[model samples]
Target: MREVVLVVLQLARMTVTDLLGSLNLPEEHIQYWLNRNEALHNFCSQNETCYSKYELNNKQCWGYEASCSKKDSFSARKAKCTKPNSWQKQIFKKQADFAKLAEVLSTITPICVSNYSEGSSLECSSHLRFCRAKNIFFDFHNLNAKNSKRYRNDVIQKGQAGGNCNMLFNEAALRSRADEKSYLQSWAHELEHFSSYPTFEVSKRQCDVIFEKPTVLIKLDAASSMYHHFCDFVNLYASQHVNGSVDMDIDILWWDTVSFLAAASPKPLIIHYARNCERASEPSALATVIANKNCG
Candidate 1:
């Protein structure tokens, strides 16, 4: 189905949101589709096989250190990457737990993306997740590492990288540039990686488990400052609307083809006009989502 293709694109590291921007899809139409779509759930269940890290020995093993600088540079370079039997055994033991993780997310779909998330600075998101048509960007900033670090580190000095917000979803356990998550400090902030292509869909049952309060939000301009403006906007909206919660999911897009999915779906989707701000500033003006939506 259309969702399946989107998942393939994500697995391939493409950005669906960017792809859509290139097409003639209306932003609201895309949002409407996202508000009522099933592809995200399918992709999550289908692509579960790729969620885990690939042990170094699976393809061709290498003893590259943390920096991936070859220490020996001899057979180390040629070492085949293989599945760690011990790790596999552990996974089997933890199958129940892992299944639980998926079960929780099995019903949720990412309707759209917002690339506007710059912490207190008022900058827009480098990228955002969108539903087929829904504009799910109001809180996109909360889901952004770039925005969080840019703001949090400035205050807490946690040493996390600024603007590096894709959640590090590489399945092969490749050395990632992302730092650890504030919640899962021991583990790299890899959970956010699922946000790129989107890993789960909130089913009715899951919805009961997790409550999502939706609202309108602006995607921040990566380097631009809009913090004060956003706060003011939130207050302004809250005065008129009771549904204002100022929460949105922020994530990265691993693939580029993700931008094209709009051609198949009838629903309107919300996505960055180009790549997420995580990668670039919004085009001087809304150019073409297709031409400018490059991940590289």
Candidate 2:
């Protein structure tokens, strides 16, 4: 009965999205919220026994009072369930594919193949000059059109704005401001004395340097250099990790990125992205973004 109801709810949500047509939210964003809805239902159901036990004793139910108030309806449950960070974190983690992404990231050979290996002064200078000229060097604002004209006109126009490290390297955007590229380029060279390790543990740790900074990650474009690098790398790694290639949809990637960011960083960051990012325009999309913004 619960499964049937969940299915019906999912269909209803999809129907609303379809009715919106081009005005609908990004398919990726829509599906992301749908997944969240399912997770919310599952979470509420899983704790049903606990809620009942608490009620029987005439005690205040932990997640029920503020979140699941008026438990007779699903809409009320959803609105309330999204209020707490702890609840959001659990819902975000319920994504099995996200675990796969995380696993691949933890296991794969990282972009940092070596510790900071300084280049010659002339070489570093040239790289810096190229970056500054293209406005893709250091300032995050420069890479974003909202801040720098050179960035919007040159970097974005040249197709360098929303690519992964591999794509950036392919497009010769490697010397730009990407944290991954910066380490792989001159900055690491300055710290060349730091030892390098070829093992997965060191690679994972090096990657963590980027992942640990969700605040920075949330500021850049979702498809920006570092973001795409991490997301695409996971897909590539997962393909090799399993028997056949695992080709996850772009929507799933978006969902994973959003959920991860929501869990680790401030809600305002994600909310700002939804409100400001070029891709997010419709009301429903903004609502979903705001709704899921509180993930712990």
Best by lDDT: 1
Q: How displaced is residue 219 in candidate 1, in Å?
A: 5.7
Candidate 1: residue 28 lDDT (0-100): 29
Compared with the true structure, the alpha-carbon lDDT of candidate 2 equals 0.22
Instruction: Give the per-residue Cα lDDT of candidate 1 at 112.
Output: 25
Error of 1 at 140 (Å): 11
Q: Could you tell me which residue pairs clash in candidate 2?
A: 116-188, 117-188, 117-189, 118-189, 263-296
- Candidates in order have lDDT scores of 0.23, 0.22
Predictions: Cα RMSD each: 20.7, 21.6
Question: How high is the lDDT of residue 78 in model 2?
Answer: 48
lDDT, candidate 1, 228-250, per-residue tens: 33433322222111111111222
User: Which 10 successive residues of model 2 have the least lDDT summed?
Assistant: 3-12
